[model samples]
Target: MKRESRQTTGGQAWVVNRKKEDKKMEPKWLTERRQKAAEDFKTLPLPKTDEFWRRTNLSRIPFDQFEPIQSVTNGAAKGSASRYLPVPMMVSGELLYGEKMSPATLDPNSQKAGVILDGLQNALEKYPELVLKYFGKGFQNRHEKFLAQNEAFWQTGVFCYIPKNTQVELPILLASHFSGGNQSAAPRLLIVLDKGAKTTIVHYASSETENDSIFLNNVVEIYIEEEAHLTYIDSQALSDQTFEIAQKRIELETNAKLKWVLDIQGSKLSKTNIETVLKGSGAAAEVLGLLCGNKKQHLELYAWTQHAAPHTTADILIKGTANDAAKTIFQGMIRIEKAAQGTESYMANNNLVLSEKAHADSIPRLEIEADDVRASHGATIGQVDAEQLFYLETRGLNREEAEHLIVEGFYEDIFGRIPVESVREVMRKNIEKKVGVIA
Candidate 1:
């Protein structure tokens, strides 16, 4: 594949110049969808002017310099997959993606239950109808530039489907590890749980090294049918020189339940948006986020929970800590529609500024249209408490140790909410490394 030079006009010439042989092989509907997104990407402006993007600037990024990955290739080393797997032995299925996605490994029971877990390209070839039925159906942001770009140029993806009334006893793991610099990748993921299904999924994304400069724009869509349950853990620990923009959309039907955990600890600049919509009565969602930023890193997150039906409920809590000259931003919103009577929603964001040069921002909002709904929001931005530090120091701990203990305490609440012990441990270790508690 040939790399195209940056164009001053919209920086989208590369899309037109990309190879079309692979596109020609894809289904007509899929090809047409990509074509529409390509056109949309050419016209949609960078989201810097939007209110949600006002806190973070996208103008500084060299959008045209990075070469887009053209195809799926094994970007990671052989026999090195264990590093990316959260629990190698415990998972019922595993899919690893470098530039190319590996064949999924599933247990016999899961396969016999009609579960489908495979690379998106393979899934499209083998089960086009299933892929077409749910692909891009839950995404509500039609005009976002990055979302459109992913839709147009995504080279690798994971597709997982749990059949109706089937329950997977173990979690499934999807891991992506990019290995090069000066490259960009668009990876998409689709997960569908039919009615009365139950499962847990762990999605992890990272770069091979801590210093590789890359750009990653990814999208994930999830659908939970009536009475289905899903526990999703999404974690990102990319290179310090990577710029990542990610969006995850989830839709829940009647009596559906979701527990979502988001852990972000890496990337030079990361902007993530997570939206969950309760479209049926008795649907519920619980979201927990942990962000740790160090050095000159900038991490921003936007979480929105929408209650569109009566008896729906949502709870969101996000905690972050910034060290050195790092910056962190959290924006949360809870919306209750007019027909969502008996809706219960709450959102809270708390931040700890570890150094004077560090910065943190927290914004919480609530929009309630239903008379009987209970919605509230709160936020806090403060430095490490001097009294608490002193108290820990008095217990024979050094200054660094005391600060680490306090930071650990701050994140303990979020960790306790995570159902998977291994995932919690992995996140705890990452947090410790970020806080300089461990090498």
Candidate 2:
């Protein structure tokens, strides 16, 4: 892993453990802003013993020793970007990370409508107006240590702008792989869509080397304006020895549409949280996730849907498999405010245990203040049906082959729903490995 100050495309250097408020004489203007943010972070409290964290063993996370992320000057050390999608993936007409990245490409029509897509650090200086308007506004940290920690430390990120009535045909991929040395990375990603705009986002996580990395403290925030349509697909396949804590927030205005899918199959300790705030009437959100854990790995996921407006709708499905001594937790929530009349929401979680030693938990919650709203949730945990396995074995298949066929059939239902073919294939292969069917 490279140090935080490693050189990259521009003359700019990466930051590590650098705060917004430090008295360093780097740049007075930026220093002042950084200082303010640091002050705010200091005032926030870390998450302690709480109902929300009851199921999670927070002590396992290395919270006390927080370090800055080292930068990568050796672009050749980084791996090529991958997209699990049929749609062609590129940034500014060139394959992503094909060469050293300088500036992102923007569509001509989007450019004509004042849409902007640029590096986060560069955009902070170029379009301060829009950055200041949406950054950290929708994602308010309520004394959470990780959120506050990210707010103080994160420096580099992405900035996207979409003007009214504009639509981006292709999805944008923000894929970066960090091979860790001895430091931690606090990656920050910010996205904004103006009213009546539409776009898709794909963010991937990778590593340069398969070293015993520490932490990838990452955060991503999305702000969708009124009537906007947003689709976000995230894939994380970091090194198995690493630990990752990721958070994604989505804000939707009236009649806005949000679709999200997550495929995670790496890291020894991985915790991912994705939330959607429906702030507009008739707003809708859909989420689907696939994860696999094996060999003492621990995977946790939290998905939340907040209905702040009337007639909002939401649907969520999360499926995964655990083998060996691997463990996984699936927690989901749906909240309907008093004013959110006629809201509709549904959630479901299904898990397949491949080994007797494997463990998994599912928790679904609903908080409703509107009696007129409709909300429901369901969760199931079980092993492969032995009767079905027996039927397959009688057809000249071995016990192992029979079980494999049953497990594949079980996952086919959810995998068929996956919109991205590349992602679907990745999930299929991962699931097969979990069942010891595929190498």
Please, what is the TM-score per model? 0.94, 0.84
Pairs that collide in candidate 1 are none
* 132-246: candidate 2 lDDT, tens digit per residue: 7887887654446566556655644667777888887766666655655545666777888888998777776755335445577688889888999988777777666677788
Q: Identify the runs in model 2 with alpha carbons over 4 angstroms from their true place.
A: 1-16, 19-48, 63-67, 70-80, 83-102, 106-114, 208-211, 389-407, 429-439
Name the TM-score of candidate 2. Answer: 0.84
Badly placed stretches (over 4 Å) of model 1 are: 1-13, 21-24, 73-81, 86-89, 209-212
Q: Tell me the lDDT of model 1 at 298.
A: 92
- Could you tell me how far off, in angstroms, the CA of residue 191 lies in candidate 1 after the best superposition? 0.4
Taken over the whole model, the C-alpha lDDT of each candidate is 0.84, 0.70
Per-residue CA lDDT of model 1 for 1-439, tens digit only, reads 1322333223463485455534457887787778788878877777767888888777546677677777674444433444675444378888887575566788999999999987788899999998989999976457778888888788888899999999998888888888766788889999999999999998888885444467888899999999999999998888788888898999999999999999999898999999999999999999999999999999999998899999999999999999899999999888899999999998889999999999999988889899998888899998998898799789888888888888898998998899888888778777777775732
